[model samples]
Target: MTIPTDATPSGLGGSEPAVLSFQDLEVQFATDLGEVRAVNGISMEVHPGEVLAVVGESGSGKSVTSMTALGLLPKNARIGGVVRVTEKDVRQLDARRLRQMRGKDVAMVFQEPQTALNPVLTIGDQLVEALQLHGVAYGNAAKRRAADLLAAVGIPEPARRLKQYPHELSGGQRQRVVIAMALSCDPKVIIADEPTTALDVTVQADILDLLRSLKEKLNTGILLITHNMGVVADMADRVAVMYQGDVVEVGSAEQVLVYPQHEYTRRLLDAVPRLGAGRAQLGIAAEAPPIITDEVPALEVKNAVVEYHRLGKPSFRAAEDVSFTVHQGEIVGLVGESGSGKSTMAKCALGILPPTSGTVAVYGEDFNRLKRKDRKALQKRIGVVFQDPAASLNPRVPVGDIIAEPMVIHKVGTKTERQRRVYELLEAVELPRAAFNRFPHELSGGQRQRVSIARALSLDPELLVADEPTSALDVSVQASVLKMFMTLQAEFRFACLFVSHDLAVIDMLAHHVVVMENGRVVEQGLREQVLHEPREEYTKRLLAAAPVPNPEEQRRRREQRHAMLAAFGDKVVEIGDVPHGPEGP
Candidate 1:
């Protein structure tokens, strides 16, 4: 908890001049409901060669506060107080000067790189455009600088990558490209907003390392905005905790994260899922009774092999010889990094993707062999929850109808009966009955995910396949959803195939664990055997890469992971090595 003062570089402890500073800042929006206060009177500073992380939940003004520096807020937004960058007040800048200062004096790295970059443009084109916008370079000179920037960010084959489109690059690569663009003009201050949220653990670690190195090399101040405590622990030299549009706490990383003075900060840290903490520590109830009788397993996948055939390339196996099982009243966790075939296995089990070889059985019946009618009948007993509920739920449909669609398809009840079931489902998910009339967009991310869960369970299916259900949610929202899921599983006693990249969540919910890599099952066994005493080097690497909330522990883990990767050499699985399948590779 006590980080040595010497751990940070000299002159980084408030003695240096600030590159960016906010004084008595406040932001308000004019909405249909009324005037909404997004950011209250807040003051902070980002000093040269230091990371000042702003940690908060969604809608806590983290992004809004950062965006104000660039004048990125909507025209209708009302702002007050002073925001200074390099001794110049941003609010006082004209349109022309603001545009010039944006990428030159201050740059931003967005959360999702896919949306941040122009999809139609090549990576080189985007980088060149950024440089040319600030009058840094143009034409052949810009192209050369573009490739150099890519190389500086540790990307391989920089020139060839420049020729490729954004879609061609992996998530990690795209993020690096975004970082490259941000570095095109060598800005004095960088605002990174949830930079690694969509990445896998190994990729996240690499991105954090890249950011840290960039800060040191450029001596640029960084204002990091994120909801992830692990990211804050790993990157921040100082921490500021925001709650309900207010800065509730601010101190050194060790002081705030380890010995928080505010209750909100402590609660935020507690919401994080700690590695090896187990379900009891997270307040999850005991596991449901075992379904160990001599009966058919709830779901069984045997030596399954699934392949995708590209138009001009040779067919590749997405899942090769993968096998696992989930008994009634049990939860089997499918976990791995990106392109590890975890979701491919889940899809094969859900009968959404037919295997090239081997078999998938549901309640002792071969799913591939079932007739159309029989398959439809079998589907009535299955439910699924995907990662992004906003994408999964129909925005045009009401919540009640979405939940009742399953009953209607199966012709199991009359209209009145369906309405009753809808209410029951709403209650089961702990949603207000008034939500029945609301659309998916009208609710928060966590609320929409709960609605998705309610719809999935509407049919009272005996089996459920959840694919990274909590990955997109905030930590506190995720905790509530997880608790609800566990409670539902205990009540219904349905078998579950839970797919996720988060090891802490997997450890909490899964009775059995299955680890995959490059479409192959590297390890599978009871949770205690696989998690507590992992034998596979791959599993060890994964465990080592997962960040803890404690800054000191996370620092040690990072060092250990670096050493392990060094020892393993080329054996580690690189990101974007294979195409992620429908469920994800």
Candidate 2:
């Protein structure tokens, strides 16, 4: 079941097929009461040797459009309009042919790799199965190519990963493996959906560079679907801004990213955290709430030491004399890369693993010296939101019950009070009350996270420890969620311990910042100071890796070049002033 191909460009077309084109595409789903038009009249064209970015927020029909192009929708789906590939139409193709086109010609990288890949099967076996099913020569040739593909996607020890299951790999590694699998068949047009959502800023940059280089070398057209405007600036040659199933704006990257005329487009651009951008930059002058410490800090980790003793070698001291305080009403950001022991320190703080030698105090109560019952109460005070909401949530439980469980455990309030609080908390996180009856599976990743936050806040704790809360969300959605947390913090006067690898997010949220490396506090200061002038080497490295809207910098560069041409046209090689641009060069 091959999806259809559109007509190729005038010259330099693929002999394989006319990449992919959408003409008046409409996708509708029948509901219990009425018809839902998910994708409405979207017309797009993608040629070889180009990257066409489809940018929009969730429910904006970007995913529906791309997923429908490969015949991946439900059986009852109603699809109209022309989706042509090669000389055939994708919408007209049967199930078998559509399956063939999906991996071979049009490869798609879904948002979540944990659920996308089979849990039982090893990555190598999955790759082998894909190769065989898609008409690849088995034996040595298939094995060799699989290894090459893994290495190409920046996965180290490629051969070992082949034998490893999806769970064995980190979230970032799993995403890279999916990208590797997508590229295995030499797809004419690759659709990457939030490809870097799970990756660190540095890794994201590497992946983007890899995609650009590969696309150029293979002359493949890339249909990148993401809500991250920063990515659009970096990789997209052209873009189509979609909202509510309609194309609101379409133009070259320079036109759409820099000179965006649409309000929605402008908002989308502003949503991404700019490296040098501040609230003052947007004319919204605000300050972080004052830190509230009751006798002792809200959460005080004094001389926290955690060590990992590896077999047949010297023991590793992960956290060496780590000490920090997250006071009430203050958001403290912990920024670092993977394996820097950021999560390890978080686990120590949560009492998931007791520290080797440290004093942890909650509300002036020494938690490290408490009994099990006392510790449980202490744990309730420090609410934690994990990285992956789906994996953290129980699939069988309803969302409302999930949020209510905390209150029930602590017996903080009566049953009626707890239920009432649940709805209020849900509203606080911007989730509908009806979501209470729904399972985690029914919600989007972002929605599930909102539920997670609502559940954390249900306990009415004075402190919230969110570990990479917005790491996997779209930029605009992330901004909304970030702002929501800030507002909630102000309203409730609760402290927040925001753990993230992204500096841009830390810049926006944290009043005070703490940079960690190998579980030690490398740098600690006020947020404004840390972001502007990072003193430690590790802190500077992390700052250097922050992702900004690449277009803003690129646009500034182009404008400077144009100004140079205008100011000293024809007459010269005069390389005068570069003219101070909008921050990053």
- The root-mean-square deviation over C-alpha atoms between each candidate and the true structure, in angstroms, is 5.9, 8.5
Cα-lDDT of candidate 2: 0.76
Q: Which 10-residue window in model 1 sums to the lowest lDDT?
A: 576-585
Candidate 2 Cα outliers beyond 4 Å, as residue runs: 1-18, 279-285, 307-318, 364-368, 550-585
- lDDT for each residue of candidate 1 in 149-253, tens digit (9 for 90 to 100): 888887899999999998888778999999888888878899999898777777788888888887776777999987778888989998888888888888888
**Residue 150 shift from truth in candidate 2, angstroms:** 1.7
Give the Cα error of residue 164 in candidate 1, in Å.
3.0
For each candidate, what is the lDDT?
0.83, 0.76
Tens digits of per-residue lDDT for model 2 on 1-585? Answer: 111232222343434444788888999989675898888887887778778888887778888888877888887689998987645688789989998887778898878889889999999988877776776647666766777778777777989889999987877788778887887776778888888776766556556766776676777788898877777887887788899889988877778888898999988887777665644433234766666655556778889888877789898787888888988788888877666677887787677877778776667777567899998978888788998898899999999889999888887788888889988988877778888889998787778888887887777778788888886676677777777777678778888788887777777777888877767788899887888987775665555545456666754543444354456442211111111111111
Estimated TM-score for each candidate: 0.88, 0.87
